[model samples]
Target: MAPSKPIITVVTGTGAQGRAISRAFHRSGKWHVRVLTRNPTGQVAQALEMEGMELVQGNFEDKGALLRVFEGAFAVYSVTIPPWHQQYDLSMGEYEQGVLQADAAKASNVQIFLFSTLPYVGPHFMGLGGVELYDG
Candidate 1:
């Protein structure tokens, strides 16, 4: 008998990057994909469900929710939107969210914790055609 595929939990699964990651894994047919989303009734979430990805409704700020979603997962793909992105109402800083996700993944004993981040070059290149990737 063939062995079962490993499970991977993806944060922000309703977002573009998260959805892309989930789709890539789903296409491989090597791992079971589980996605965490604040809005399970949203279009992306509903589409992911139809494509055989498990949906877990939750928010990044809720530790209990994160723990529940990450529990017993082989890996976690975490991606947080930048603060400047008007698409999301960010209650906390991006770094803080990243730390929180890492902590939750650790607590849940998740083997692989993949975090997506952008460099903070705003301060370094203050006046040289300054472009802030993310503020706070």
Candidate 2:
């Protein structure tokens, strides 16, 4: 069989890091890129869409929505902006979203999972469901 073009899904697609990663993939032209964001009609989403990227409208809070988006996706790029994320769900909510996303990634049979996290500040694994601190 011919090689299939990879489907890459980037969460928090409107965020700085997320956007950068998405752009990188788009530049490579080796894979099909889709961005997951709550505000699908937002400026950022529209911009990416105009550039030939698929914009999947959904949030981590919605499991059904996530499953639909993940369908046939070969890879997923998970990203959570801790600071701004905390504003949405009392930090706990942010953590929960991450965990949910991870589970969804597995359920969807995504071949590769790439998570983008802060280096110095460290990454938070929402699956733990607890608080941890980082020096940075």
Candidate 3:
């Protein structure tokens, strides 16, 4: 059988890095970029839509919503923003969101999962520990 074109699904697409990467993939022509954001009708989504890229609106808190976004996609770029910076008490929400993304990936028959994460200083790192990447 012939190989298939890669479908790139970028989670957290409204964020800075996700949008840049999505644009790069869309420009490369080697892959189809799908931008997944919480606001599909927001400014970024509207702009990306104008560029001819696919966009899905959903949040990590909703598993069914995530599964719908993951369906038929070959890969997913998962990103989680820490809530603490916003002075929210639920700072660990990122981890919870990651867990939901992981379950969605497993049930979606997806491969080639890519994650953009925080930098780690050494092999024995602490904190998030790239758990977002590992979970995906």
Candidate 4:
């Protein structure tokens, strides 16, 4: 019999980076990938599910959901898009989501917490104006 694989919970699993990360882990055959997304029926979510990933329906703002998803997870990969990139308003700021996910991972005793973040160039960089960076 094959050994049981460790579980890794992935946040924003339907997005580009999340999809890639989840696929890599799933293809490795070493980790059981659990994906968290608000829409379980979305195309990307369905694709991942078909590939043997377990999907947990939830949003970042719901602490209870986050906690449930993190439970028994050996590692977590969290990635949140900027507000400007999102089509709808998020219940909390992007930074807040990061902090919340970290806290959830800690509470769940997860061994690894991987947070993907981008640097805010804002007005500091040339030709980048009118960009408001989300502050936790």
State residue 22's C-alpha deviation in candidate 1, in Å: 0.5
Give the best candidate by TM-score.
1
Worst 10 residues of 3 by lDDT: 119-128
What are the clashing pairs of model 4?
Answer: none
lDDT, candidates in the order shown = 0.85, 0.75, 0.74, 0.84
Query: Weakest 10 consecutive residues, lDDT, candidate 2?
Result: 127-136
lDDT tens digits by residue: candidate 3, 87-135? 2234347778777787787799888777655432233445534545533
Candidate 4 residue runs with Cα over 4 Å from true position: 1-3, 119-136
Query: Which model scores highest in lDDT?
Result: 1
lDDT of 4 at 70: 91
Clash pairs detected, candidate 2:
none
Lowest summed-lDDT stretch of 10 residues in model 4?
Answer: 127-136
> What is the RMSD, in Å, between candidate 3 and the native fold over all Cα?
7.0
TM-score of each: 0.83, 0.75, 0.75, 0.82
Relative to the true structure, candidate 4 has a C-alpha RMSD (angstroms) of 5.5
* Deviation from native of the Cα of residue 20 in model 3, angstroms: 0.8
* Candidate 1 regions with alpha-carbon error over 4 angstroms: 1-3, 118-136
For all predictions, the C-alpha RMSD in Å is 5.4, 6.9, 7.0, 5.5
